[model samples]
Target: MLLMLLGTLGVVMSAAGWLSYRAGLQEAGEMFDARLVQSTRVLVSLVDEPLSELNAYPGEPIVLRGWHGEAQGVGEALAFDDGHAYENKLAFQVWDTKQRLLLRSDSAPTTPLAVAEPGFSDVVIEGARWRTFTLRSSNGRWFQSAELADIRQELATDIAGGTLLPLLLALPLMALVIWWSVALATRSLRGLSMEIGQRHPERLVPLDPADVPREAQGLVSAINGLLQRLDVALARERNFVADAAHELRTPISALKVHADNARHAIDEQDRVQSQELLGISIERVERLASQLLSLSRAESLGGARAHSRLDLDALVRTEMEELRPLAERKNQEIQLTLEGAQLWGDEFALGLLVRNLIENALRYTPAGGVIEVRTSSTGTHAVLTVEDSGPGIPEDERERVFDRFYRRLGGGSDGSGLGLAIAAEAVTAHGGRIHLGGAARLGGLVARVELPLDT
Candidate 1:
């Protein structure tokens, strides 16, 4: 940015300096022309009276008044106590109508300064160009004033240089100022970078946006949003680890106890009983591990898995079919009503969502209990509901049931208490909502999930 700004400044300054120089040159040329015309008029005013009384002698040489030498003489001396170097650059001459030179200055060329035309003109004498102004008096006498073109050009160039020199000398200072201004403008960005870089790796808190420039406000907001999400994900991961450790302790201890009982049992029947108990403990551990994995997946779904469009009805049917044997083993009746529900969501996450709801229903419902699963869409939302013929959650505890590892007082003793929590996370990741209440028909717990079809 600094380099670009400096480059632009340099270009503009150069263009301005060139234009200023051109203007100066033009102004100087006009002043020089005006001086020439004024000098010619002054000569006509001063010489007309003097020349009219003088009679021109034919074939007689014209003698200049100021110098002792004749008008045609070369190498003649003219002395002044304090003469300027520019004196030789100006010259004047007077001529009669018959074209005889009446008077001349030392610097004037022997020939006429210009043609008999009565205005300003350019002429060359002795290989040097001159600007000349010719004027005719009322007596038909002519007066002319001329200056060397080289001297005029030199003066014009000096004027243009005077106009451009200051800018040329200040180029370095202007570039420095531009560089400093660019640095000052971008100091906020640098501060933001430094603030981020100096933070601890575990610190995922947002940066302050108040002092940020308007152009970078959106960028800072986006970064703060990402930081908030990272903080959430990190907190979830830490909680999952802690919860998994806590949940693993009971089943693992149970398995250890059963293993110890089987090892110390004297009777074969006692050993068989211990082995059975150990198998049950192993199953609980496996179920807890699976539930923990599902919780992690749901929490991690976030924004990354929200792209795929899935059929809620199809996913619900598939999960129900897979869990059918589990229901049949308990002599439970599983009723499914799929109503062509479609929504935008991750297929895998939505499948998990459906499985968790139905599995929770199957776990809590007693033997011979009826579990009703439904999938339907209402234009803007795809809804999935699982109702069970089990003890319903209390209204006060319904919201807390979605908390990680939270369970009701009389909930299933062997459960990991993560099914509803995982289901809730999945719904949230898809920008949906969940509600828990008593089923109108089943007279038990009802877990209703409303997922947006538009996403």
Candidate 2:
């Protein structure tokens, strides 16, 4: 903005200076012309020859027959006492209508004056410019007057120089004024920076718009909007931590009581039953703790984690290997059918996603049922499939499966039901989508995850 102002000021100042200089030159020219005309009139009245005699001879020297018809010698010049001494200094010559040289001023050039039509004329004599004027007298004599052209040129130069000097001098002052205005305009921005710098790290309060510049109001409003969102997010995290701790305490306490009872039992049969009950209670507590941690991690992962290229086929195989023992304990087998496919995702989050899906399938499948994992790439998407030979979820309950702690009706499993929810959250964090349906090959649940091939 300052540069633009300076450019505009320069154009205006240059134009104004040029116009003022032109006007000054023109006025000086007009004043010089008026003085030249006045001098010509005074010189014309001094010729004293008759109209007929003046026109008779065309190229002869008519010796000055003075005002009393006396023979005046060449040095005995007629002195017209016009108070202006500069006019006396002017070179002039007089001629008759017949073109005879009647009289000449002592200052006139030695060469005879060139005859021209009566008016203003320019002539070069001795390599210098001269302004000349010719006037015909009532007695048929011709009066010619000339002034040096250098005088008018000098006057014009002086007038233009005088007018332009002040403007040139004021240019620095104008620049200073522009600088001060710009400094005042940007003062609000400096104040805002100082205010922000002094703020505490925990203080997320909105800035005052009243003190901000109108042009920067939108920026301040956007900052305030971001602060409001952060405040809400912090508040939500606090509530989630409090609720999760409160919910887990009860199961943990139950597990502790059952373990203490199992340790005190005496008889073999009673001890076996007590041990089994304690084992189940402990498993329940473990499931609760795992679910709470997964849910908390999922909520926090929202686009904050860095992602990298991962081999989906290798990841699925690893997850299947880890779950193979659990499947064997139930008289079930885990199978993997994967293609060499790569995906971009957070490694830890994708591992959590695959682990939860496989665990969900294992917990719901019957003793003799099998769980299969598969990974393949299609066009720009990487796909992962986990299928189990178990009762499939109904179409209506499929959407609800991703809700935290939402267990299915008639589902027989000592699980926290948060596995699918964790899988959904992790998939979303990687810019992926998850779908649940009946598996065509296994006639059971199928969980498919599709993610963009590029990050």
Candidate 3:
């Protein structure tokens, strides 16, 4: 940014300098032309009578007296100590109507100073260019005054140089000022970087936006948002660890107690009962670990790659196939009604969501109960619903069931209390919503999921 600003400034300054030089040259040219016209008028007034008395034939030339600028007689009093070196460059001539050069200055050319046309003109005499101005007097005499072109050009160059010198000399100072301003403007960014760098890893506090320039406000806002998310994710991870430790501690203790019981059993029947208790304890630990892993995976889905487009109906049908064996073991009938629903989402996560819902229903439903899974699509949304013959959740408890490690009281089911929580996270990751209510047709619990068709 600094380089670009400097480069632009340099180009603008250079163009301005060029324009100033041209304007100076033009003004100098106008002034020199005016001098030429004034000199012609003055010489015509002085030489008109002298040329009339001269006995010259037509087209004849005669020389008149001219000044050398040396101190002589009365000219000594008029001469200045510092006279211009260009005084000798001026010349004049007088001519008759017949194109006869009757009178001319010593410095002037022997030939006519210029063409007979009246007005300013450029003429070359003896290899030297001259700026000449001519006028016709009332007595029919042609008066001409001229100056060397080199003198006028030198004056124009001096004027233009006078105008451009200071600007050229100050360019370095201007560059220094621009560099200082750019550094001062970027100081705030450096400070912000320093502030962030000095922070500890655990310090996920937001930076003060007011302390930054307005140009940096959006960047600061984005960083603050990231810090907030990091704080939330860190808090959740801590809670998950604490909850896992707490949940595992009870089952681990039970397993230890069962091991001791089996070792101290007085009879074979007592030892067999202890072994069964130990098995139950081990199953509880396994279930807890699986639920924890599922919950962790669901939470991470948001940061993973985008989900792919899939047929929701087909995925659910495949999940039902996998869960059918468990349903048959419980003597529960499973039914699927699909209508070619489609949506964008992680297939594995969606399958897990369906499995959890069905597994929950299977654990709680009585023998000979019926479970129904349905998939269909509207114009804007893809819908999935699982209805089971198990007891329905109360309206007041339905919302709370999605909370982590939450379970209904007196549910009489051996669950890790994380299935609904995992399902809720997975649905949220897919930008979908889930609802719980009594199944109108099944007369039991229903889990309904609605996801955008184009998500």
Candidate 4:
């Protein structure tokens, strides 16, 4: 930041210096030109008496000598107000109508200072530059005043340097001021960084916005929101792990008991019975473990799923085909009114969602009950429904059924109670909605799901 500020200042100052130099040079030129004109008028008036009687004067024109003294400092040029040190640098000449040199100063060249043209002009004499101004008089003679060019240039350069020196000297100080201001402005940001770095992993508390500057309030707010979400996800994960441990302990203990019974049985029939019970316990534990894994996978399905365009009705038909034999063995009829609904979602998540709803229906409905499944669209959403003509859930328990490990008291099914929870998570991952309500004309629980359309 300091470098950038300093660089910008340097460029502006350089441009200002150049412009000042040009202005100084132009102003000095005008002032000197005016002095040349005044000097010409004075010399022309003074030369009247000398040219009136040309024959009275000698063969050469008389010269007005100037002081030739040692150079000094400060007021050296105009000391004592008698004459200037630069008097030798200022020269004048007068000429008659025949171009004869009538009068000249000691420093004036014997040759004509410039062409007979009236007004200002430049000339080179003895490899040195001079500025000359000529004027026509009523007597038909001409007067020319001249001065050295280098003197005027030196004064102009001095004026420009004097104007620009202070600004250049202040550049470092300006850089210091800019750096201090930037540091003061960012102090709060540094503090915020330190606070975040010092946080404990379990410390998901939000940062206070009161101390933050208005310019950075939005950033602080976003960070706080992230911390809040992380806290929620962590709490949920803890609860899931605790519940899974608790649920697995009972089945594992039963498996161990049956294994011991089978190992110590005396008779062959007793050993076989014990082995059968052991197999049942093992199956129960396996199913419980599988349900816990599904629940874990469902909870993590928000961001890591591969999504695709899927036919909702087609996925429903596939699950029905897989479960049709189970429904047939129970003497139950599986009814489907598939209307070919198209949706965009994760294929695995949506397939699981479909299968869970249908299987729950098959498990809960009595023998020979009707399982009604339907798929349709509402322009922006594709809808799915699986309903069974069985004892529907109580109105009070309908919402709780979607919670992990929740089951109705007398539902007559030995489910691990994660199927509905898994279905709920899959619907949420797809930005969909699901609800359990009474079926139309069937008087049983209806699980209706709605998802965004593919378009």
CA lDDT of each prediction against the hidden true structure = 0.83, 0.77, 0.84, 0.87
Measured by TM-score, how close is model 2 to the native structure?
0.55
Instruction: Predict model 1's lDDT versus the native.
Output: 0.83
Candidate 2, residues 158-205, lDDT tens digits: the string is 677677778778878888998998889789988988988998867888
Model 3 lDDT-worst window of ten: 67-76
From the highest lDDT down, the ranking of the candidates is: 4, 3, 1, 2
Cα miss at 157, model 1 (Å)?
A: 4.7
For the record, the alpha-carbon RMSD of candidate 3 to the native fold, in angstroms, is 6.2
Compute the lDDT for candidate 4.
0.87
How far out, in Å, is residue 390 in model 4?
Answer: 4.2
Model 4 has a clash total of: 0
Instruction: Point out where model 1 deviates above 4 Å.
Output: 1-13, 44-83, 92-105, 108-129, 133-144, 150-196, 203-229, 249-290, 301-310, 328-331, 377-380, 394-397, 407-413
Worst 10 residues of 4 by lDDT: 73-82
Off by over 4 Å in 4: 56-63, 67-80, 86-129, 134-143, 148-152, 244-310, 318-332, 340-349, 366-369, 378-381, 429-432, 452-455
RMSD to true structure for each model, in Å: 6.5, 11.1, 6.2, 4.5
Model 2 worst lDDT run, 10 consecutive residues: 65-74
Summed over model 1, clashes come to 0
lDDT at 73, model 3:
32
Total backbone clashes of candidate 2, pairs 3 or more residues apart or in separate chains: 0
